[model samples]
Target: MKSILFYLPTVGSHDQVLKGMSGVNRQNYRNMLWQLTEQARAADELGYWGLSFTEHHFHVEGFEVSNNPIMLGLYLAMQTKEIRVGQMANVLPFHNPLRLAEDLAMLDHMTRGRTFVGIARGFQKRWAEIMGQPFGVGGTLSDAGANDRRNRALFEEHWEILKKAWTTETFSHSGAQWTIPPKGLEFPYDAVRSFGRGLDENGVVQEVGIAPKPYQHPHPPVFQPFSFSEDTFRFCAREGVVPILMNTDDRIVSRLMDLYREEAAAAGHGELRRGERIGVMKDVLVARDADEAHHWAARGGGFVFENWFGPMGFTESLRRVGETGPIGADYRTLVERGLEWVGTPDDINRKIEKLVTQHDPEYLLQCQYSGLIPHDVQMRSLELWATEIAPNWL
Candidate 1:
């Protein structure tokens, strides 16, 4: 299976705070950046497919503070030669469509076409509240029926505008949520109005599009990160966007892939091939022995389960899906349920092979680093994965 490293640049001290420590050490953000860059270089040299980053804001716990993944993507692009750099998702509602489109196009050019775009309707309520937009709409975990519908509609409108901006030379949009070059404005009404000169002689707004289109013809590959909604699956299939599955079981993934294939055929996109458009992410840890692997995986997994998912209300969601037996449990339980992989290289390879035979995923994203795992330990796990497990797939 093709492999990608899921990078979340969390400050080590944040874990201490989560554990109720009286005081926490302050970490230099620059050092974290340097470490991540180094890791990206290693992944590149090791022949990993790509590195995917997450986005968050106002997260004091530093669970994932990558507010601007495009900026990080640019840095990684410059530091590496071949591996693709991408965001697991750029929260769609949190950004201006035109600005996001332009930035992604620039990243594609800067990376020499080694850019991947993954879009999502953001989940964090605080972010939407800060931006004066409604949160928890459509497919969000906290969604309440109608409000969720409205939020999803807004996301769709914004996405439509972004796609048009990238693919069309001169496009005009009049959607419910936005109007480009907004109507009913005189040419010289405002100083900023004259900047783009996007107006006709009759004072009507004119069509506009991004300059320096993109390095990839049409655009770079677009991916939709995992969501439970069939609508998302159908949309990805229809648009030829790969779907990245995470935290879900193989049965669910297999069902979703079947749905995606059926939708693709219905949409005249032809039959979906095995291992072509699907990707899966799993928490992976490799060590000298099973005991060492379990110890570290338990620490990291428990921390993530409590600190990250607990506050976000995702633990209950997983319980509803039968992925977890209870909150605040031991990681061994999770491991037994196939939610995580922690063992020797042979053990990991066996589990991964089972997944590959069952799901036929095009890519397997290894989530090796998270919550309190020492940098050196994480690196060692990665090394083992590269030297021992990766060759089997090849």
Candidate 2:
């Protein structure tokens, strides 16, 4: 079934919005939580399949106000029944694998197996600065590649550990980065043959295991969100990770699918399976009439595009170690890029149809709440889309 997922952003307007790509504001966080809960409850009633939260550390433009996606997921699970809850992603490098395992396990149980985990290597530099760390800044992928390689390795490594922790009776590991202490003398920490799967030095095998066995029988579905990089796509296909394409252009999505399927075929995997979802994130606002949508967007969406996507598209600049610039300096450039799109239900539907036909995505995620948008207008947009647009698309 084609599903709709919503990206909930809970931050107001900001001056240094680009500095922390996904940072959450404290006051805004409280306000958004209530708004988000009401929205999710509505989505459940409306038969939407899932809702997702993005992870961000420090961005001035109000990308993500709340830093804790897992906590949010659990809260949603407790509040709702049918709708699935998840993180659009958690940057693997910024996590402690063991704690992640615990959180995922507890959440899966609480949600009764409605948790989807999207993992990625993050791209924001201002967040790095907040942590007193350094990265190749200003769109420089100098060490990003190496960092990605390490992050991927560690991410997969921890995935194994978490899997082991869930299924095995008393799992023990002595890998390069992790070692689970032995439980006791009576139990040798020998997980069952069907505990879980992991990679050894050689090739793929099903004999290995991870513990506290996932309540979902095998495991919860794991996806890696990517931006259509050939290397990244190939890696995802090879590693049995689902490809969750984000902000991928129409042409790029087609090329990626072909390449991904070809590689999977060459690997003797027959046809690519299970990795069918592609995520298109757009700044969307829907209204009963075009003018209202346009006006609301002109006010709210303009700021979102200018503050959020503007810096990234043009000059992805960040001070090195310790540098400074006027606040909102990049906002004008972002506004110039023309990233915001606002329209009435009909116009919005036309654009969506074009995108859907071009990309043929199995899912479309609407980033409806963005950039300090007013609560009433945002709700109207959601309701209109749910009532007018969604049924037609389905």
Candidate 3:
């Protein structure tokens, strides 16, 4: 299985209690960046397949402070050679499609075609509200019965435009959410002829294409960060994008994979490729003994539940996605449901083997840092995972 190191670039000292949406200290922020760079380099040296970063905004609690994962990817890319760098997801609604296209193309070029793209419609209502997007899932935030379809529509529209921008020499778009080449406005087709040149027979000006095509042919591999909806699974299968499974039971994951394979076959993509088609993310904590591992897991998981999920209203978000079991459950319940793997090296190894055998995922992404887990403890877990567990899969 391919192993990936997933990072949130959390910015707060280990001793600092998570009080929910707290402010960030500049020194801590700098230190976090440096440490993340160091850890990423270590992962690269240790034969990791990729290093993925999360993107979040306006979280003062430092739960997830990597606001610009593309920038972080670039930073890590400069320091490493072998490991692929990517975003766990770039929230679609929060960005300008043209700018994102340009940035992604640039990143692919900068990384020598080692950049990957993950797309999401986003989940946090606060992020949408702050960005002046239509908050909520199905409709505007003010709409009481809103669901996620509206945001999904926006995400689809933006994604279509981005793909066009990347592939077409000159493109124009007229869609529900965006209008490219501005209506009723025109520019000179030829750069040299500034005054008057290259107008259409109807005196209409042509749209200019975005420059610097991506280093990868057509584009880099696109990923869907979390797969929960059947529509999303079909979309990924049809478009050749991989879906990353997150915080779901093994049965659900298997079902989703089966659906994806069926869709791909229907779409004439042929047999699904192994070791490159699907990814699974799990929270992992490895210690010398089960007691130490469980201790830290409980503390970290509680912090994630109370501060991260509770404050961010992610429990409700999960409900919207039809994941109801672990919404309000305690950390132990979550562990039992396979959302977390916490124990000694042998214990984690056994759990990993079972997951791999059952799901047949191509990539295994470990979320090793979260909540109030100290930097030292997190590093130790990484060290143990890389040394003791990762080799078995290889």
Q: Give the best candidate by lDDT.
A: 3
lDDT of each: 0.73, 0.60, 0.74
Q: lDDT for model 3, on a 0 to 1 scale? A: 0.74
Residue-wise C-alpha lDDT for candidate 2, range 1-394, written one tens digit per residue: 2454546474654333444533445765666677777777777777777777777765444665546778887887788889888776776656666677677767777899988777766666567334324322111132446555655566567667766766665456777565555323232232422443342333333233333455675567666654446777776666556666643244456777777777777767678543354455455777777777766665554555455544554222211223355324233332233233467888777777776666656566665654466667777777777787889877
**Worst 10-residue lDDT window, candidate 2:** 132-141
RMSD of each candidate relative to the true structure: 3.6, 7.4, 3.6
Worst 10 residues of 3 by lDDT: 135-144
TM-score of predicted model 3? 0.88
Question: 146-168 in candidate 3: lDDT tens per residue?
Answer: 35556767778888988998898
TM-score for each candidate, following the candidate numbering: 0.88, 0.74, 0.88
Candidate 3: pairs in clash:
22-60, 22-61, 137-147, 137-148, 138-147, 138-148
Tell me the lDDT of model 3 at 314: 39
RMSD of 2: 7.4
